[model samples]
Target: MAIELKDLAPLLLKAERTNGDVDPSVLTNVLRGGRVANDRRKELLQVIERHPVLSDRDMMYRNHDERYNFGIKKAFHYIKLLQEGGYTDPVDQQILYSAMGEPTAIEVHRSMFVPTLENQGDDKQRAKWLPLAKNYKILGAYAQTELGHGSNVQV
Candidate 1:
């Protein structure tokens, strides 16, 4: 009798878990920064895994344009889920994105653009823009020179 590759994965994973000396939960907690964070990650992962729109299974079969459009769809659905679930914390949103295992179109907006506004924008700017960003009324993106190229204009 031959085992399918899919069937073998779980066996290998189970053996690895059983043979490991360290407790997996303890390791997970340490890696996730602590017990609270680990629990939050697990909870959000469950929500992501159960959502059809968030699944990444079909991504490999998509063309570049299809993938880009799919990413946008996933991003919108995820934001809606976050709003409905009341996941207001940025950390929770990050965990949810990590669980998705793929970058959405809005990732740069949330990760870079929003942080820039919060950090550098004046009080008046933040007062006007932060609420719009937070409420999903506006989406922002950050653009930069190619990697390894410094911000030198002459270059």
Candidate 2:
């Protein structure tokens, strides 16, 4: 089901009641351009509104695994809807980046690990490796964090 902005109204109200500062309007503006659209979007909003992390004072301080899992679950659902509706612009690098920062295997699998192989590897490599990776028959990780190399290591 696709989400219309109107369906998100009650979820916004509930969010305000529960989290106080989330401003469903923010998510509304970001995803829907302040226009209500469908039930799926509303469902996403409802989940966000009802989440225990809404009580958090700092978003970055929450458990990395938990936060990533939430973002991944939401993102996958949102991506599916956008793709089906012929709407390609709503979910972008920011959303995927947010999900990638999450510490869950699923998030890495869907957002990072998949893209890395698809974009960087050769066709033969992809054919050989992608199925295993996608099915979780083999697991992968980005273990490039450097002690002294800093963020510029990619250079």
Candidate 3:
């Protein structure tokens, strides 16, 4: 699906004309807290949407293993892409994580493992684990309770 600039010219012109004093960029910057943040956000969205693997078009149909495999592949590229684009902010990572579909190791790594390490690990341990976790060398997850505990806890 190739779209030519001319094909969208009319819509773009209409939007520009109707925009008035709105200065969409201003709103965008304000929403993101500043121009730099907004630009990073737009860049992130473009990267994710343009990447073939990051998409979730036919995800629901995939079985658990298939989905997990796709997620692992995406995770590798996710780190590479962000690093290539010079975005090291964890906030940006959170944005990308939230954009993706179907729960995966990345989600658990971010929402659980990272926090657990940060809160519980000592400096020496963190020095060893953080880099691997940061580079997606090792992915992890945390479940709410131990297997036997289930949803019932007497404590």
Candidate 4:
């Protein structure tokens, strides 16, 4: 008799977990930096998973425009949650976003644009732009064009 597809997945997962001599938690902690960091990540994930807007269900069925709109909604809600939760640490924010699975449009603003301002901008520029960028009052984009390289921007 053949196993059902639904049954096969659980059986395989259970077998894999039970058969492994190495403890899964230990490996997870190492990857996450430590047990404390892993715990923090789990806490953040719980918050994200409990939110309806962040759910990945039906995402594959969405058209490009729908997906884009949905992503913006998720990003907005996620940012609000971060502020309400008092999560100012970049690492914590990154972990929470990673749990969301898909990259949202604001990701470029958070990951690239914000960092560039902090690192490269003068004090006056940082003072002027950081607040607006961080608060999402203005969204930022980075564009790089290499001459004679067509659309490829990579060096």
TM-score of each: 0.76, 0.36, 0.65, 0.76
Count of backbone collisions in candidate 1: 0
Error of 4 at 140 (Å): 0.8
lDDT per residue for candidate 3 within 1-155, as digits (tens), equals 99999999999999887987788778878988799887877777776788887766576788989877877787777777767877678888867765665555477787788788888999999999988877778887665655476756565
lDDT of 1 by residue, 105-126 (tens): 9888888889998999999999
C-alpha local distance difference test of each model: 0.87, 0.56, 0.77, 0.86
For model 4, the local distance difference test gives 0.86
From the highest lDDT down, the ranking of the candidates is: 1, 4, 3, 2
The parts of candidate 1 lying over 4 Å away from their true place are 1-21, 143-155
lDDT string for model 2 (47-137, tens) is 4444444223244765978666665565454444334534433244233324333333355565678789999999999999987865556
Range of the 10 consecutive residues with the lowest summed lDDT in candidate 1: 146-155
2 versus 4: better lDDT goes to = 4
Candidate 3 residue 111 C-alpha distance from true site, Å: 1.4
Which portions of model 4 show Cα errors greater than 4 Å? 1-21, 144-155
RMSD of 1: 5.8
The candidate that wins on lDDT is 1
In candidate 4, the residue pairs with backbone N, CA or C atoms under 3 Å apart (3 or more residues apart, or in different chains) clash, namely none
